[model samples]
Target: MARNKREEILDVALEMFAAHGYRGTSLDTIAHRVGLTRQGVLHYFPRKENLLTAILQCREEVNREHLQAGHAHEDLPGQMAAIVAHDHQLSGLTRVYGVLLGESITHGHPAQEYFRKHYATVRERMSASFAERWGDRLPSGLTPQAAATALLALLDGMQQQWLLDHTQTDQPEIIRDVLTVLLGSPPVK
Candidate 1:
């Protein structure tokens, strides 16, 4: 029950942090939503930053799980497309990701190191996937590393656009169209 409560608090924190940037969210707001006092919240998080760290850690763990499921080893393009589809449903987490990522690009942000290491790991794995799928080079004359970087940039750009106007943007279609260039066809579900 105690562990469940902590998870619950984290969920609320994730939602609040997504709706309002980290600096805009307070321990009071999270505690209030969770029906706990600020002191009670502190008993679990100790500090608001600690809670933020936990939220980010959770996100990394979930992403790691998805990667470890052999998705990258199998049909990478299909897996990547599936990831985009999955994100469509988790708009809140995506918003939190984009907002925090933009904020962390500046110097001295609390999440700077975390984001740095996280992207390095993501890029490494993605580059490997591209290499395994496309051999030494893609049609554009870019190496796997360059292509992986471009793909990441494309995904982020599309996500930001979709987040701004979901009704106007076809996130999954755009993602699939991009994958078509890599795989010769859009990845099937």
Candidate 2:
């Protein structure tokens, strides 16, 4: 019962955070929507930042599970497209991630350090992967570090666009096409 209530609170918080951002959403709002008093919510979360931390941890675990499912091709391009497809499928989580990521850019945001470390880790891993796969440069005349940065930017930008008007964008296809061009190879599929 305790775990269930905590999960329920997390779900409501996730949706509200995605819709209103961390700064805009309040614990009172989350408590109200979750059918709990603020003190009740505090019983589970203790602090609002604690709640945000839990949500971010849950989000990371979910993404890690999807990425490790082993359905996508083992290659980098295939993995990249698979990631975008996965995000499209999990639109709610994606929205929360996008909203929190944008919010993290402001001064002294709670998630600022989280996103900073996240980007650094991802960029380091991606740059290493590119280097191992293609030496110093990808076929697009960009160095591995540059490619990694550009790839991250492209993924984030495409996600924002999809969130704005998903009907107009075929995100996976676009990612695959752009990746093919960037990697100087035929499309993954």
Candidate 3:
């Protein structure tokens, strides 16, 4: 589908933000990339933080859809493997998240609260789903919540490695190996 102006701006901004950290990319550059004026960009997003929020939300929606694609199975590690495979094709988006996540580590960064809330929501949803099928704790003795935290951390760490050297790091294989250890030797079918 052809993108509307706002969508076009967002697409360009996502790419730009992915290429450059949030602080490195400017609205003027984003506007120039999309053939818009500063005011035109502002018409959709009054602040850069707003644009960041919109971009994060869009990414979350897409990730949620990917995670849910295999929800019928009780195999969370499998679902996560699928998410890893999916993320490989969206490295730009992954870099955008990694950069912003690092910057958001500082207290009161604009994306700080959003990242905090996003993580809590993700952990809650993942744990809830896993708990329903696998019980509150995995065989590894980690609770579903703890497992979720570990899984997210693994993804972030692997993304950093992949972003640094994509040719050498196999993100999905690494994730799968870790998940096998955490979930079980055979990965629950």
Candidate 4:
């Protein structure tokens, strides 16, 4: 019961956060939606920032699960396309991620440090993966680090665009196409 309640609160909180952003959502609102009092919510998460941390961790775990489920052995472009396809199915989580990511840029935001560290780690790992697959530079003639940076930027930009207008384009297909241009070859199936 306790675990279920906690997960219930997280689900409600994530939806609210996705709709209203972290700064716009409040603990009281989340508690009310979860059929808990403010104190009840506090019992599970002592601070609002703690709730944010948990949500972010949950999102990362979801992404990790998708990657581990046969996506890990693929080439970089294939892995990224798989991730985008997975995200397309989880619109709520994607919205929350986009909201939190945009808000994390504000001064002293709780998620700022987390985003910084996350990007650094992802970029480094992505660069290493690129190097492993294509030596020092990609077939597009960009260094592994530069290609990694471009790939991340493209993925983020595509997500933001898709969030604003879901009818705009097919995200996974576009990603695969652009990645082909960047990689100088089509992504392996």
Candidate 5:
């Protein structure tokens, strides 16, 4: 079907972009990888920037689904743990995003708007979640926005470290430890 082919092209292009930086990936490479001619690929994505935008949009949808699934759990810590566990269980998509997001900091990167909007939306949703969970018990000076930003930063930093040294490090444990310190609770056993 037409939709299936479009999805296939998108998947292949995402893998290519993740493996090689955006500047290094080409429509020709993506077409060859997807077993399509350049013109065929162009039928689905007229421009490389369009393909990049599609990839980022798909990633945001997938991440929002995953986070929402975790949020269905009973408590904030449980939700956080589920999210962290899901990260460890999945392929390196999160790591790939981390790399791309870092690269997007350069001037005129194609994904700048995508990454900026992604971070803003994620921060707002997370802050709302934290406020819903701990509004009554939060320390007098604490703010939900600050807590959300800290949690996101911690997760990003921990995942980067895990990607660098998965053999010697346990990412979920480190995240649990950090959260325990922040929440003044015992670490997950």
Candidate 6:
């Protein structure tokens, strides 16, 4: 029961945060949405900063799960497709993270550490994947870490574009094409 209540609170909080942003969202708004008193909400999250931390932890878990699942498959294209599909499924949270990450540039934001660690982990994982897939054929002057950083940057930029115009083009196809060129492989059609 306690776990369920916590999840309910987090869910309501995510919705409120996504809609109103961190500063714009209030504890009262979250409590009202979850049908809980302010004190009840406090029982789960003592402060609004605690709730923001929980939300970032939840997003990290979600990203780790998706990345692990994608990595389990040996086919790189299939893995990329899975990632794109997962992003489509969780676009709302993705947008929320993007907004918070941008805001976190300000000193002492609750999510600054979370975003920093998240980006570091993402870069490391992506670098390892790039090395595994293209280590042999990489140009003499190129390093896997550099390639990984570029790939992650590309994906972040592409996601921002897709979020702005979901129907302007097909994101997965665009990603597949760009990756194919980078990896010297044909499109995954």
Q: What is the C-alpha lDDT of each candidate?
A: 0.77, 0.86, 0.79, 0.89, 0.73, 0.75
Candidate 4 vs. true structure, TM-score: 0.93
Off by over 4 Å in 6: 67-71, 128-141, 185-189
Assess candidate 3 and give its TM-score to the true structure: 0.85
Ranked by lDDT from best down, the candidates are 4, 2, 3, 1, 6, 5
Q: Against the hidden reference, what TM-scores do the models get?
A: 0.82, 0.91, 0.85, 0.93, 0.81, 0.82
Which pairs clash in the backbone of model 2?
A: none
By summed lDDT, the worst window of 10 consecutive residues in model 5 runs over 180-189
Instruction: Please provide, for model 5 over 79-151, each residue's C-alpha lDDT reduced to its tens digit, 9 standing for 90 to 100.
Output: 5666766766654565557667777888899889888887899899987876786783444345778777888
- Model 1 residue 176 lDDT? 64
Model 2 C-alpha lDDT versus the unseen true structure = 0.86
Overall local distance difference test of candidate 1: 0.77
Estimate the TM-score for candidate 5: 0.81
Candidate 3 clashes: the total is 0
Per-model C-alpha RMSD = 3.0, 1.8, 2.5, 1.6, 2.9, 2.8
Give lDDT tens digits, candidate 4, residues 78-152: 878899988888999999999999999998999999999999999999899889988987788999999888998
User: What residue pairs clash in candidate 4, if any at all?
Assistant: none
User: Between candidates 1 and 3, which one is better according to TM-score?
Assistant: 3
Candidate 4 regions exceeding 4 Å error are 186-189
Question: What is candidate 6's lDDT per residue for 1-189, written digit by digit as tens?
Answer: 999999998887777777777878889888988889999999999998998888787776886698786565535545665577677789777777667877788867778887788789988997787678777344434477876676677777877777787773577666766666666555555
lDDT of model 6, residue 170: 70
5 or 6, which is superior by lDDT?
Answer: 6
Error of 3 at 157 (Å): 1.0
